[model samples]
Target: MFSVSIKASSIPMSEREPIQSSMQISRTTGQGGEACLLLTGSCTLSALGRRMGDLSDELASYASDPNLHWDLTKIDQMDDVGAVLLWRSWGGSRPEYLSIRPDQERLFSRLGKAPPLPSLPAREPLWIAVRIGGGAILLWEHLTSIVILAGQLLLDMKYLIAHPARIPWREISANLFRTGAQALGITALVGFLIGVVLSYLSSKQLQMFGADIFIINILGMSIIRELGPMLAAILVAGRSGSSMTAQLGVMRVNEELDALTVMGIPHSLRLVLPKVIGLGIAMPLVVMWTSAIALMGGMVVAELQLGLSYQFFLHNLPDAVPLANLWLGLSKGVVCGMIIALIACHFGLRIKSDTESLGIGTTNSVVTAITVVIIIDAIFAVIFSDVGIR
Candidate 1:
């Protein structure tokens, strides 16, 4: 009898290991006078996936023969993975001439009757209306909380006014000193630099029109009426407001706020009101201080750039910018400071009891305070436009 050779080299070199699990396929005469594929050896999940290429590479040679058959009588072992692989090779159906044991036939018949794999659900498109509605709900909640906090603060203030002895003067004093005295240096430096730059730029433009004297008016009106208070508010928001929020948040994390409540202490009156009243009292003074320093800075630049005397600048400043503008700026400081303190305390109280909450509360307090300050400044500009214009 002549023997035919089957080579593992027929598969890719990556699967050429002689010791690995493998399959043998050979062309042989079938019962109906056609060539068919002979599958033999152990066909199982353990080896079928790794030896897939060895069988798939030669499957096409006997596929078109009308009498093609599967002779699996020599298969020592079989599994679902091997059964499915052979089923697919036969165009996902059983061959009429399949010669196998009762168990293998039952396995192929069960696999054929199994339902198709479920398809994945399609993805849905995003809806803008849902997103907008959710955002609106969140914004409404925040605004309502702020309004309620403001009302509580007003009630506390009215009570303090009626009973002065019950007020927490010591806490107020400490916060004032911390937020005001400690902040003076940076506020002065920033105000001075701003004034100098404003004067320098104004001198260049005014000199073109022989309007050098008007630089005093420009610098005075801009600094005292707008820049001074806005600058001070922003600086304090970033510095003092963040600290307040962090302090309260830390207290919350440590459960000191709850302890205070247990001892019959009102957190709003002791913690929140003190900060609010302190900042409201200190802010106007800080604004005036910043404005004076900035004006001095403007005077120095004027003297050097336009040969304008300090006396002329001082004398003209009062006439150029009215006392009403100074009052407007001071009022802005009071409103802005109260808002900042309240907002800081509000966020601080909302903090979750954790280190991450402390940091997030402080950052949110600073950002919200600064944004509110600018928005209030704009509203003041619109309402009092005719009052402060020189």
Candidate 2:
């Protein structure tokens, strides 16, 4: 029989004492060359519990010992807190050599076993056609609402015509100033640059054929028939239409429109009518101003690059571009203005009692206004295309 040798080293008391205690292993030799261990002291539940390194060291030292046995016989306390260490150290087998008392089993069970992890759900692809179909339905509903509003406007036309004097001139003037005056600078600048670019492009091709003298024809037809009215309408739609929608939407949220109705005042006359009239009046003027500036810009380009005289450019502009072109541009402006004003008022009246609705209505007004403008322009394009005007 091999005699058991005891080598005990007393550890100093410190913050990590409880953890160190679990690491302390007692080696003993028993009958028939049996080697055993006594696992003692603190684990996870203890105030200054066992260190992970302590468990690792124990597992490593026991790994090479195929016939090693452990004994918990002298363990005054035990826990599942060290169950993982024991199970792993014993090659994932229960430590059969170490007998756990009944009371020790109850405490070990309380530490709980690890649970299985959950699996992730798979992703599905989106059906884009269905989403677009739903959007189309929503767009149809919006258009139906606009048609109903138009009918209401038509029904109230008699009342409006009878009481033209009751129209809010002050409000109309203010909206006109905003829609027209404020947009003039930007519209003019854009128109001028467009005219310069058009003249330059046409000059490039015309110079090859010695027709650079006809640059005025390109500038006049392009600006008056298309660019002038389109640019002006778009600018007003974005600026004034958005403002009108947001303003009326705020008023609707605050119940001011209702209050006016209760006070025996007309909501349409006080709000919608003024904006509509103002936009109608201002749009043609803005288009005229834009067209004039564009022509001037084209004249400068023609003189500098194409070597055409300012007098020749101006003289030929009227013949090359008829007054009908100006009228057509003005007509487009008037129609665009009415569409923008109507859309803004319609969205404004539909606003809910929230700031978000005001924002939505304002955005809707600009988008709807621009869409209507383009559609109307397309119609005009088809109508004018047969007249032999470029």
Candidate 3:
């Protein structure tokens, strides 16, 4: 009994408590002879953290040696994730020489018995067709949801009108600050840069044709009528839209959305309405600000490149761009702002209670909002094509 105790005590430390030790790999014999790659310590997901990739790579490298034994008998803790990871590293088969605990052996046995994932057809020609059909179905579903949301928002508007005291004033004000005030810096910088580039490129072209004065027409008509509202809507769709989706998604994740519903609070009346109205009111102002800053940038560049005066640019601007154009741009702003808010809220309210869904919903909201904004702009351009132009 004393000799047996001494021999047991002489055994490798890795054969002891894996809970207290970090996982590692070591060879049981010299490199030139037959070797065994002994795995030790905890093999659970919580233990692996970020080192799974590196460990997988090392395992794969050692797996190339057909004669090497994979010794997992010393491992004391392992979950399915770690085991599956090993199964994949071994190319879906056990190593030629493996030493494993009975419990661990059961895990690999189950993995081996599990049905393989259904494979795709070989070089299917209808793959793109299938994808397009799926996208169309998704788009139709989104459109239906959006229309329902819009109708609900309209009803909410009626409800608020009848019960003025129930209006979400604080929510609207908060959204105004978030979607409008916080967005000014980026809009200003992008607008100014766009103006400078437009002016520089136009000046060079106009100089060749001896039509330097036309720069004012180009800058004023394009910036005021098209670029201003477009830039503002795109930026808001990406920034404020994504933010709204994420906010609602997080609320859903935290079960706050469910709580509100239980309290007899409708999302459209309280949450969605505020964002729509706030952004609707704020969008025109943002568009006006972006247009003004951009024109200033253009004016500066025009003065330097074409010897044009700021006063001259400002004076000709009124004649070059009609009042109708400014109003048209503002109308676009209102529509875009409301639509962006609606799309964001629609996507947000539909988000499943998961981090993965939250991320996916936010991304889809931004992309869909931007695409819809562009579509709206195009429709406006077609219907009001002659309204703003000379």
Q: Better model by TM-score, 1 or 2?
A: 1
What lDDT score belongs to each candidate, Candidate 1 first?
Answer: 0.85, 0.76, 0.90
Once fitted onto the true fold, the runs of candidate 1 whose alpha carbons sit more than 4 angstroms away are 1-131
Evaluated against the true structure, the overall lDDT of model 2 is 0.76
Between candidates 1 and 3, the one scoring higher on lDDT is 3
Better of 2 and 3 by TM-score: 3
- The best candidate by lDDT is 3
lDDT of 1 by residue, 1-390 (tens): 111112222235566344435567766987678666687765776666566765655564455465777788666556787787777777777777778866677779899899999999754355577678878997798789989988988899899899999999999999899888888999999999999999999999999999999998899889998999999999999989998998889899899999999999899999999999899988988899999999989999999999999998898878888889999999999999889999999998999998887887788889989999999999999999899674
| lDDT digits (tens) for residues 116-207 of candidate 3 | 78998686689899899989999899889899989988898888899999999999999999989999999999999999999999999999
Q: Whose lDDT is higher: candidate 2's or candidate 3's?
A: 3
Candidate 3's clash total is: 0
Report the C-alpha lDDT of model 2 over 99-188, residue by residue, as the tens digit.
565555554445335554677765435658767887999899889988877676665566767877765779889988988888899989
lDDT of 3 at 348: 98
Steric clash pairs (candidate 2):
none
List the candidates ranked by TM-score, beginning with the highest. Answer: 3, 1, 2
lDDT of 2 at 294: 87
